[model samples]
Target chain A: MIENRPFLKFIEHLVLILGVLVVAFPLWMTFVAATHDAARMGQVPLPVLPGPHFFRNLDVVLNEGLWGGDGSGVGYMLVNSMIMALLIAFGKIVISLTSAFAIVYFRFPFRMGFFWLIFITLMLPVEVRILPTYEVVAKLGMLDNYWGLTVPLIASATATFMFRQVFLTIPDELLEAARIDGAGPFRFFKDILVPMSRTNIAALFVILFIYGWNQYLWPLLVTTDQSMYTIVMQIGRMLEGAEEAPQWHLIMMTALLSVIPPVLVVLFMQKLFVQGLTETEK
Target chain B: MASVTLDNIQKTYPNGFKAIHGVDVEVKDGEFLVLVGPSGCGKSTLLRMVAGLETVTDGSLKIGEREVNNVEPSKRDIAMVFQNYALYPHMSVYANMAYGLKIMGLGKAEIDERVKNAASILELTEEQLERKPRELSGGQRQRVAMGRAIVRKPSVFLFDEPLSNLDAKLRVQMRVEIKRLQESLGITSIYVTHDQVEAMTLGHRLMVLNGGNVEQLGTPLELYEKPASLFVAQFIGSPAMNIVDTKMHENGNEVTIAQNVSLALGGGRLKDRAGQALKLGVRPEHLVISEEGANTLPLIVTLVEHLGADTLIHGHFGDDKTDLTVRCSGTQSVKVGEKLPITASLDHIHLFDPATEKRIEF
Candidate 1:
């Protein structure tokens, strides 16, 4: 920057443009294919530009199930995904907040042991404990239910750590002052701790919602009922019996629909999301 | 509007380290008692124990008449101004002041009235009351902290080094403001600071602590004139009291000055400690420039500090290599390396037993 090297600046811009193209190319291809009909999609080197059948394809996917599958429309799948994402996001925030507060404020017996136990769950992804977790869900008769789809995945380690770090940075004097002000633990948590950590909560909500909406394998294990399938899981089911040419246009349309909610959420709350992501203090 | 009585209170941490050895202090109604000491000397710990912030490991503490050793901090009827001025960062100034009253379940009108009154008393404008703590300056933040305590109207006020975080000029200004506020409210307050000047100016009674033990407890003038030990003698005064090793002469009539020059001890002072070693303490103001004569020390001035109103001459005592300082009027012309004869009156000298370090009263 000090030398004002035009060639170096040009090289920097060139690299950045290349990086954007690499990431944006797949999304572009998906949009182009979603605009075509099944016939255009089947042709070799399928039409690179937009086609007129985008809305038709979206209408078919949202109203009628694709690939001759006996299932509810993608609209119903979208509703299921919304419920799962909301429950998981809000559930993780509440659970992590109370647990972090307990761990940080109280000096109970085996406090650290319990904390480490929760921290160890970060290593056990849903993929690793798939069979046993499914068996537990089956025994509880929670299959084909919202609880089975979201609750098992809501015990978050990263959210707990973030809340713990935020709580630890609060001055000890705040607690003492609140205590002197006649606020017991529950009142202090409701009034002081929760309000102070509002940004962190919003930020974690964005991340957790995306994480929940994109979940593929776990929902596949729990929901054998077609009506209970989420949009992401239904997209996978469209690929079965594809020895003939697959329905590329409808698949692309479903993928685009599944991605719209989270993208809109992040874009609308982009400021709070970035602040919550990068900032711990006001 | 109540008395605070600490009867042999003690604090021992969970690790078995005793932070406050048995401290006994009594704050009468409307009295301002200051606990003054160096860092880690347990001044803050003692104040915390009284505020119910720290547990009393051994003895009972009473506010008014009830034993509050086991009471929660909220039930103790006390308000504290922390050193960092811990205002609720998210709340406005009025809300910060009204939060305690709201928690006490005070009505809306009553809370509003008290908050407005406290804000006016603290000179916070209506526009300023709606701003958060972060929007205020350091001095304004300090006043908000006080306003929070004032709105509570608790029986006792606890201050834990509240002025330590301010700059020097602001500290002086706020010191006056705090004194004025305390006088008007007439609350029983226990203030803690490591600054002797603050303790001297603000306290009706001073309790000096050293290493978790009470060194002396008295009025500022009383402690300045008649210290109980060597530590008190040195700690309370600026530039410190000059203490030197000296020997008592035979017949208990005189003491040696600078190992050889003998100054006669008048009126039979220390008559019982004959021919024994003792420590001598003399405030710099008591030492005068004397003409060359008997019972005088001829000193070569080493450093001269002119403070506009007074001058301090630092030098050794008569070439014996023992350091001594003398205070004189600022108009006096004194140069370094110049010999000046200095002497302290016998009536103003303090003698202490070397073994005990306790002052020997004449």
Candidate 2:
């Protein structure tokens, strides 16, 4: 279908330009809301210019919204969410990479069965098994605990699959060279394999980081206390409590703050992501 | 220095596919042996077995005084240069050269010294040492791969079609360079290549493998001048040795093409079971341009590939002989459709029993 007059030329560029603006509009609107109060934010056309309420809104967010009014009281929930997401991302990447390496490089019994099992998980979304997972987490005494938030979603099948695909393309010669150079499994990985796989690792880092930060259902079910709630879980509570009338400005501002980390990660790692993917294929 | 001995090496894949049979080749200390064959000939598989990359299905592999069949490649003290250069693309030339040394926990100064020495010998300038493989040309990447192998000072070196990836001119240059390097270092090396010219030039002794069996093992000139079988004779030369169907007649001599076009042979008659269907094998350069003498065959030239130094005349041997290629010096100006009688010295002719497609027993 893309064979003739492919959408990679002048016309496509124009469409792409419009596409960028379309995506950026909501994000820009979030930033604009962060600068204004509820009145100006909820208007028909939406605020697009600088306003005096930017610092004022920040004061409100930090004061009553995030830190609970007292200057000394920084609700510890923010730190909890930050730790949960960071640890989950880190844990997921480590597990995925190691498992991926094993699945791709080693020849052992039941290898094909294990690989297919992991691959089948990729097609089954986390939403399908969320209730059963939550029941298991409750029985393990993991409710309102960090383990509950991170453990269930820590093993990312997609990242493992991606890493397996990446590692498969690595020249067998490289591994043989390492072997000849007196490098054992660990040394080979540290000195050669990991360095060659920078791009793949970088790509997986972004994927796992985004997946962790965007986690809503698992964290929502596991954390009963506000102190253990993640940013996404907090967003869910905030939107739910609004009932009939919502504080769109405060919600938008919180969302903008939540999105900043992942967006920044993607922007900074884009070069690495592209480079790693290309090198893996090469 | 080490002597590598492969005793009854066999390779069978997961699907019950036996790629290599009971193959045996012993390489002496400081020897340069090349495993040469056509594609799918299992030559590379045999070399990988010696390198400990392929598992020995039934036999034993010993390096130096140790049985390396179950040993890891690292502990075996071997260095391999791959067909694609396989120079760590991320590493600079200096790092590529020094990697094995650095990983072995050599001192920084020692690693630098060895790298510098290899670079100097390879004629890589200081500026070139800082560049990555992508930045370097094909020839330079190949040199860097060599430098990496050289710095290891391993007991044995393994080369797997290292020159196959280079252009023709670069391949020629690298072939001589590798031979000279191997000679100067006097390291025991096993080189694998399908290019017979490379096998001839670089090897001290050549092992010609087919269907996983060693068809012949001898000095390059031995394999060239006296190929053990019809396979070896046809495989070891360019334009391939002209293999034509002939017949074994009464007495010890065999008639080639017909009685008037007969070729004399020293090998006695074989029973039909001996596959006595006679075949004539002659190198292009051995054929004389005119048919005045015995052992000469007249041919109508179909095409002439004039390559300055030599001209290859593609022709037919008889109405029955479909394809025959003759090689002569460039001085001859024989046109296509012109009949030329080429005389071959009786001693230079190789006789093959067509039924088995093997060289006759003399």
Candidate 3:
């Protein structure tokens, strides 16, 4: 704005357009594939323009679910995924917040030791501990249940550390003020600490919801029952090698369906998400 | 509403560093006691111990006749306004003020009434009350913070340098408001500040502290005119009191300054301490340029600061390297390097035992 350089501005616009095309091209192709009939999808030189069978494909996917698989509908899978995502997001936030509060505010015998223990878990992600976690869930008889799917992934070190950092930035005087105001520990946490970190919570919720919704590995390992299969994992079942080749149209439709809720979450909470992501301290 | 007493209160951290060393003071019912000191002087540590934010390491604290050494801060019935104005940033002004009442489980109507009353007393508008803390100006936010404490109606009010965050003009404005508000409410209050002016203007009695020990406790004028020790004398005033070493004469009636300058003690004030080394103290305003006096010292002016109303001349005495400052009328015209004889009235002069750092009698 200060220079008013036309050539530099033109180059900026060109680079932005290229970035947009790079991201949008895959999404455009998925929509095009979802719009065509199964026969049209398999033909040479797939349709660049969206076909007229978009509504039929959506309806078939929603009601019939994935073809050549279990009879459970895509609608039910969508509901299952929604529950898992919400539980994971809410559970992670609650646990992380309380743990972070304890770590930051109170002094206990093993406080730093416990903090470092949680920090070390960040190095061993779910992928590394997947088998043992699955065995424990199965031994606890939680396999094929919502608890098995969400709870193992709920105790997040990343979320806990972020909340710890957020809590540390809060002024110590606020705690003192609350104490003098006749509010004990829990009341201070609820009335002051939680409300103060509102934007960060919402932002974390957006990210966690997307993370939970798109979860494939853990859900695949535990959900042997097709009734509890998430939409993301169910799409994988539809792509198994079969006699009539893969159903490209229906699988693409399910992929599109799985992406919607998380997209809506990020879209609606975009402002808070950006605010929480950018501002570490007030 | 209630009195606070700290009996030999000591605060030693878990790592074995003592912040407050056996401070004992009594704040009468509805009296404003200001704790003033330099940073790390344990004024804040003492205030926090009174607020129950820090544990009393080895003493007793009582509020309203109840020993609260081991009591929770909330149960002790005190409210604190922090230096940063620790208002809940996300809450509206009304919510911030009502939060404590709500936590105490007050009914909706009662909470609303108290919040409204406090808001009105603080001169905050309805619109301002509805806005969040970040939306208000610094002074308005400070008022909201005070209103938060006011609505609680606690027995004691604790302020931790609340106005230190404001600009000079706003700080002065809030200082008067705080003093007036405290007077109108008559709550037993304890305030902490490193600013001497704030401490002098706000407190009914001032507690001057140094290095975790109580240096002196008295009215502002008492501490001003008769500081208990050398530390209190230098800490209480602007430009600090000028202290120079003076050797007592063998005759017991005269004190020699820089080997040649001598002043008479006027009698019996130094009967037992004739030959001991003492410190001579005089305020800048007390020393005036004079033609002839027995106590007069010839001063070579090195720097002059003119303030239109008064002039501060910074200089040293004849043949000595020790620096001294003199506050004189602005109308008096004098140049640097000019040797002028300056003298202080005998009554305004102070004597301190340099070894003990205690003020000498008379």
Where in model 3 is the C-alpha error above 4 Å?
A: A65-73, B266-268, B292-295
Quality of candidate 2's docking, in CAPRI categories?
medium
Worst 10 residues of 1 chain B by lDDT: B259-268
Backbone clash pairs for candidate 1 read none
How are the candidates ranked when ordered by TM-score, highest leading? 3, 1, 2
Per-residue lDDT of model 2, residues A187-210, tens digit only: 776777677777888877777778
The predictions' CA RMSDs to the true structure, in order, are 2.0, 3.7, 1.9
lDDT of each: 0.90, 0.81, 0.90
Per-residue lDDT of candidate 1, residues A199-274 (tens digit): 8888899999999999999999999987788999988878774677679999999999998999988998788888
Q: How many collisions per candidate? A: 0, 1, 0
In candidate 2, residue B311 scores what lDDT?
87
**lDDT accuracy of residue A201 in candidate 3:** 99
The TM-score obtained by model 2 is: 0.91
**What is the C-alpha local distance difference test score of candidate 2?**
0.81
Candidate 3 per-residue lDDT, tens place, A71-153, comes to 44689899999999999999999999999999999999999999999999998978999889988999999999999999999
- Candidate 2 lDDT over B27-86, as tens digits, reads 999999999998999989888887888888989889988998898877788889999987
The true-versus-predicted C-alpha distance at residue B305 of model 2, in Å, is 1.5
